[model samples]
Target: MSDLRRAAEEWLAQDPDPATRAELRDILDDDQALADRFGARLEFGTAGLRGELGAGPNRMNRVTVMRAAAGLAACLPSGGRVIVGFDARHGSRRFANDTAAVLAGAGLRPEVFADPVPTPVLAHFTRAFDDVVAGVMVTASHNPPRDNGYKVYWADGAQIVPPTDAEISAAIDRVGRVDALLLGAGWLVHDGAGLYLDAVSSLNLGTPDPGLSIVYTPLHGVGRDVLLAAFERAGFAAPAVVPEQAEPDPDFPTVAFPNPEEPGALDLALALAADRGADLVIANDPDADRCAVAVPGPEGWRVLTGDEVGGLLAEHVLRETSGDDRLVVTTIVSSSLLRSIAAAHGVRFAESLTGFKWIMKAGGPPDVAGERGGSSPHRKPDRLVFGYEEALGYSVGDDRGVPVADKDGIGAALAVAALAAEARQGGRTLLDLLDDQARRYGLHATAQLSIRVDDLSLITAAMNRLRAAPPARLGGCAVESFDDLSHGEDGLPPTDGLRFRLAGGSRVVVRPSGTEPKLKCYLEVVLPVDGDIAADRARAAADLDALRADVAATLS
Candidate 1:
């Protein structure tokens, strides 16, 4: 009779999976469990649906996936074509097939991938096909083994933004009993693997040195075959792959978390790199959309931060490219070193709010005739030569060559390999190149202070506290100015975050994580290189440590 019981009963009746039906029935006797499962439906947003795989409206199951599919079908044009792709995750293939079936039933043409592929492959296909109205990628993308998700991309091969997401959400609200929706069969299946591989191979700027030894690991995801194929096509030697983490395993048993950015995720790869005496190490998250790189240093091997990788790649692309209309982009939280790099290279640069959605838009097509700019002062530039974020996401190719609208780990991996090989030819390492840049552009050091919390409200409380009473000084330097991003300022769109510029040119940006329960504070300090490179690096690193402490104190 209660609302919870009523919703559970309704969901159970339509759920085709016997396991979910049994799950709901067993939890019916426990009020807390029932309420948690049916308390509210998972809200589909621009990123699409992502949650733990289980029963009930709040979880990711056949019924929830079916409803989402039906909603997406209703939102699209009557006869538009849709592309569906999935990774090797629990229930991913089932979810992808369900989406295709639902779209087919809605009188829309649905083309599903023949096998599990990377997320970037889906993004590429969505853009390559002129008839594709939208794209649905069923993957959690770097999340743990127990979770699965659905990501939606528009005709531009980018994730759905603004009004589009809202419109699709409204259509989803109208979706009723899953049983009422016809589950069609015999949808068209397409093999986009070759197309994706070719696109990745095209990103190779020139012939890489054949003797460049490398180590790679997919972290038990689906990136191995695609990356290897790309490398081979680019004329690079076959990389020695980490045997334990080479294949796609839904359980992701080796790593505590599937994301490469997490600590210990690349242990196996690093060990293999040392044993093989490789020149470089590359890793991709479970879905293979994000790439991480590591290099051997004076103190063994160390992973480069996303900021470091962005700077190195930007410089490499700019040096190889020649033109007046060249453009590079990064987020506000990313290191300011990119701005310096762009200016030095005589290329235009812009900063966007966090996320690839804004970064890709800023890196517009070759023609910006009728497109209007966004709140960021650097919106919709003349030509987007390169775009990257601090979270290991990069789009190397422009509109003409590869046409990958989203981050491509495969492309980034190829680029990194080529850069390492070229550096080797110069009798230098990747770290040497980065150090040289620091000397020219002043030592730009960065660190992060991330505090994970069990209770979500703690994050909101921290943000409120910082805004109410801003910090006056950080790292013993006077704060010059503070900008609250909520109301929008400095040409940036309204976002919930704070930015501070210290008198000594140091910077800090604090905000709550959009996808996780945590408060992240990005800290940076710029120290002139002077004459001594080693001493300058030491001093800069120490200053960054001090700045990190000060910001952490403010958050606490």
Candidate 2:
């Protein structure tokens, strides 16, 4: 037999699922398919394993999940408790069970959520307990129906970062075949939803005024119950749930991609919002770790960019909460408006590399009492008030330091509802608050130019080309400065990205997508509001459009 055939047969032998065995059997005669499957495994990393589900190591399956669990077991302290949760995705439950089995077999206590839960709930459970060492969430967030993932949250309730991710990957490499690994089950079932809901209830900044009507959708994932429960607990009237997507469906029939950020994903919810005259429309991605908001305007209903939502929420948080040591954090690619928001409120602000892990790991208040999780013991601790990324991920820290170290769409929805209620009661809307921010701080407009490629080498080549000869001008504006982020600047760890600061207070950051096969270029335009929100917004939009085109051309 050929080497590929031999490997395929070997994988089929240990594969627990009869479905995958059949899949591998049929692919054995097809060299291309076999090569795709066995050529490369989905190596675990900071985000853990995520890929199309199939029979091979390259795909997410029982064997792959078990091996990853074993590797995780090796890195954790023996006998430590590990909690496991899953979303309503195909193979999610099985993969989660496999993970629990592996951890239990490795002599650690394993607690499995009895039902499908949102990603944020699992992270909350991971952090709620003092003894829980880490967590595994079986979900791909908003990936396509055919995909699944394994996400690891450390003791801090944040996604595993750097050295830990690297360590787990190395350990996975040493793991033997699944058949050789010991497995155990009958683990304790955890009440993650109940605990998470109560915690989220405490996040509501203000009483939800009855005047603020809202519509919500989970995009056919497992957030409906939790979101509804949270809304009720926060004193908000039950949001009109999109009936078509109210139930969990692994197929995600409503949208091509389950992500709320994708176009048309919110069409059903927006239509419902219109029917109910909802003041706001909220959506959580498949696993509910990200939240997307839509608002009605003179032009009709339009979804707000993550930055717009971030800005509006920041204003509400500042108004509702008090603390001179309060700190907020954002990513290099997110809008810079947050820094201004924090500063204007006499609060501290910090920036971190992309991802909620780094955001949660950000430095804390400079030596103030009552703050729990400020990194940089060397630097005085700053209480983290809030953190967000441009990708619809926000962590709104409550009175008790940051509860969910990772993004909590459920908590954010409550915050959005509370803020929207305040706006409605004050005879304003979310859009008005956004405009008010523009007037106080300069108008900050942001857009993204994402180019997906079939061949991964194209991304590497593009990165190389940009580095060899950086652009001196783009979007009719001179590039004021260029920084190769891979070399590490502004106290950020090394990462593969490029930053271009333009002369007109505009900027662009280009980097490969960490989760998808796309080159993502984040574009931002900053202009002082000229006392007219409409004209200022128009100019900002035009500038961003030109800049986006320039960036696309440069990258191509």
Candidate 3:
């Protein structure tokens, strides 16, 4: 028999789900389908397993989940404790339960959430308990309806990276005989939602005005109850929720993609906001880990970029609280305006490669250690006032209170509401505040050029071409410096990317998407606001368009 057929047969024999067994049998006659199913196993990297929910080892099913759980369990110390939570996605609860059972069978303690919850809750709880060895959040944040994922967090409450992910992958390879694995009922089940909601409520800055009109939507994922409860606890009036999108529906019928960043994803919420005459609109991704905001702009309701939100929140936190050692963090691809804001407030600023895992490890260990299995001791864990990425991920407050080392939509939403209320009291809107910021700090216009390709090699070829022949000028500005991130620079660990600084105070960074098959080029142009702020903004916008076009051509 062929290798693909043999692997399929083996998988079919051990698969407990009758539906998957039938699926494999039906596809056996098609060689391409069989190879697609059994050609290779789904990779469990630092991000853990994420794929379409279907049969075969290449897909996300019970057998794949079981082996992943067993492999993760093998990486922990004996008798260690684990926390498991799931979102309201197809097969999410079952995956969480399967993970708990596998951990329990490995002689470890497993605490499983009774129902669906946000991904940040799992990250918070993982850090709250010292005895907790790790956490498993079963979700596919903002993916299509037919997809599900498994995310692993270590004891420090950050996503797994490097040596740890590799070690766990090795352990998974040693797993044998899915039928021989044990499944039982000794694990503990608890209401993680309550704990998470209570923690989210504590992030309230102050008593918000009772009459602030707001609109919110979870986009058919599980965030409505917790977000509403948080609003009430923070002393704000109940928001006018998008009735159709309030409930948690795994199918996510309303939107083509569940991510708030996607175009038209927030149309329903915007309509509700317009009808209610609301002050602002807040939206969370399907798993409620990333927050997006929309406000009434001159040209209708416009959603703010992740960089704008990051800058605003950084300013809010700095203004509300005062400390000598306060710090702010963002990714390299994010707008440089944050550095100016941080400097004006005397807050230290830092930049990471691209992900929250590196941003959260700020002031921690310099490199990944094999045996310790967690972040190096933070020099001042309490000093992390705020951290964010261009992908709408924010970590706010001190570790002792919030304990969230990952992106948090609930906490960010609460902060946005409070800021809006304060702005209203001063006879100003969010757009007004943004205008003031642009005047004080130069107008920083940013754009992204993302090219998606069916063949993965296209991305590799583009990167190689850029590296071999670096552009001399971009958008009529001469290139001043070129730094290849692969060899490491400016105290950052080596990563696969390139950064170019233009003579006219513009910048560009090219890198591959960590999760998608796309090559993204981030462009920014900083124009000084000399006279009319509007004219400066217009000029900056035009300059950004030219820069984007030039960069796109260079990549082509």
Candidate 4:
């Protein structure tokens, strides 16, 4: 018999978990499936373990999870306390318990969230537990139904970085087999939602406007209760929830991918908005850390891109809390309009490598101690109050004022409502305000071309091809310079990506998605708007479309 078949038979013989044994029985029937599942253990990269569920070391099954938990326990500070949280994804809760049990068996006290919740809540709890040395959140934020992930965070509440990742990986390697775990009940449960909301409330975007009407969708995940509670607590009129997606369903019945960025995912919310003439539509992915917003545009209700929403939010927040010490932070791949916007207000603008964990490196203050999250930016950036990324993650607060280092879709929605209300009070619409902002900021428009590939190697090949020989000219403009992120002085570890600057201030950035098998191309076209929103909007729209085509042609 083959080794995979032998392993499967062994698992079936010894596996006490009936469900796991049943799964193993089915996996053994298909030879190829059995091989795929049992061929090798799930490898831990800098990010941690993420794979589909099945009955092998290669899958996210009990055996694999326990092994990973054993490695984590081995790596923890000697007898250090650890906290764990899980989302509403399938098997996440079970994985959480398995992790705690494994850690407890290693003589570490593990505090777990009592129920499935959003990732941000986990992030908050990671910090709230002062005695804790590390944290784990089991979620594949915004991925499709069949997908799930495991992410590790340090005391700073950010995802694990560098030597820590390497150390944990080594320990994981030492755990050579599934049976290498000690299981026990040294696990304590806590209220993650309450703690997470308390942190979010502290970053109150002043107040929500009663005049703004909103249709919010949780996308059939765990943000329903926390988001609603946040809006209510923040003094915003309770948003009308999209009934079909108001509750947590691991199947995510309403949306195919459970990502609001996709067109079809927002259809229900958009339709509801149209029916109610609501001012805006807001959505959160399954775990709720990523947010998507739709606004009343001249072209009917439209969902804004992450860059647009992020730029507008920064602009509004800076305006509301204008101060000499204002600072705005975002990933290098995000819209450059934010730089100009920050420049306009004389606020400090800084760029971090992609990922909120990197952004969280800009940490908080000394006296305002709370949680052990990713390091803060500046001992608390003076008015260090806002950050975002193109992937729809955002943060708003002084490093020390509660833990919003992770994105909060519910919070973003409430802030947008307040901004919309203020605009309405001035007899203007969001589009009109956007036009004004763009005109002042030089009409910075951006678009992204995402290519999905089944094979991971193809993405690597594409990145290598672009890096070895980038475009000499794009969009009829000569290339002025190149920022090869793979080897640039960006003070970041080599990422496989390239950014090209065109002569006319237009730019294009190419990068592979760190967490998925996809190549991403981001393009920006700047139109100087002397006047006329309609004309400038039309010109910018055409320019963005042309840029999109240009990117597609170049990448293809």
> Taking the tens digit of each residue's C-alpha lDDT, what string does model 4 give over 1-556?
8877898897766554678788888767688888777777677766688888767777777777777788888887767878888998888998899889888888888889899878887877777767878888898878778767888877877788777788888887787555545677846798748777776765645555766788999999988888888877777778889999998888888787888887799999999999999988889898988888888765688778888888888888887675555567788778888888877877666676778776756433322322212334654334457888888887766334325556767667666777787888888877777778787888878778899999888878777777778878787778899888877434556667788998778898888877677888888888788777678778877877877787787777
Write one digit per residue (lDDT tens) for candidate 3, span 1-556.
8888888888888998888999999988788999887887788887898998898877999999999999998889979989998999999998998888888988889999888998888888888788999999999999999989999999999998888889999999999977889875778887746666677777736559778898999999988887888788778898888999999999999999999989899999999999988889999998889999999978899899888888888888788767656767788899988888987987667778788888776553333321111233553333677888888888766423344888999889988888888998988988888888888988888888999999889999998898899999998889999999988876777888999999867999999988778998999998888878889889988888888989989988
What is the lDDT for 266 in model 2? 96
lDDT tens digits, residues 2-100, model 2? 888999999988999999999998878999999999998998889899999998889999999999999999999998999999999999988888999
- Screening candidate 1 with a backbone cut-off below 3 angstroms (N, C-alpha, C), the clashing residue pairs are none
TM-score of candidate 2 to 2 decimals = 0.97
Native-to-model Cα distance after best TM-score fit, residue 190 in candidate 1, in Å: 1.8
Name the lDDT of candidate 2.
0.89
* Whole-model Cα lDDT of every candidate shown, in order: 0.86, 0.89, 0.85, 0.77
Q: Quote the positional error of residue 142 for candidate 3 in Å.
A: 0.6
Identify the runs in model 1 with alpha carbons over 4 angstroms from their true place: 363-381, 398-402
Stretches of candidate 2 above 4 Å error?
364-380
The ten-residue window of minimal lDDT in model 3 covers: 366-375
Scored by TM-score, the top model is: 2
What is residue 126's positional error in candidate 3, in angstroms?
1.1
Better candidate by TM-score, 3 or 4:
3
Q: What is the alpha-carbon RMSD of candidate 2 to the true structure? A: 2.4
Q: Pick by lDDT: which candidate is best? A: 2
lDDT of 1: 0.86
Better candidate number, 2 or 4, judged by lDDT: 2
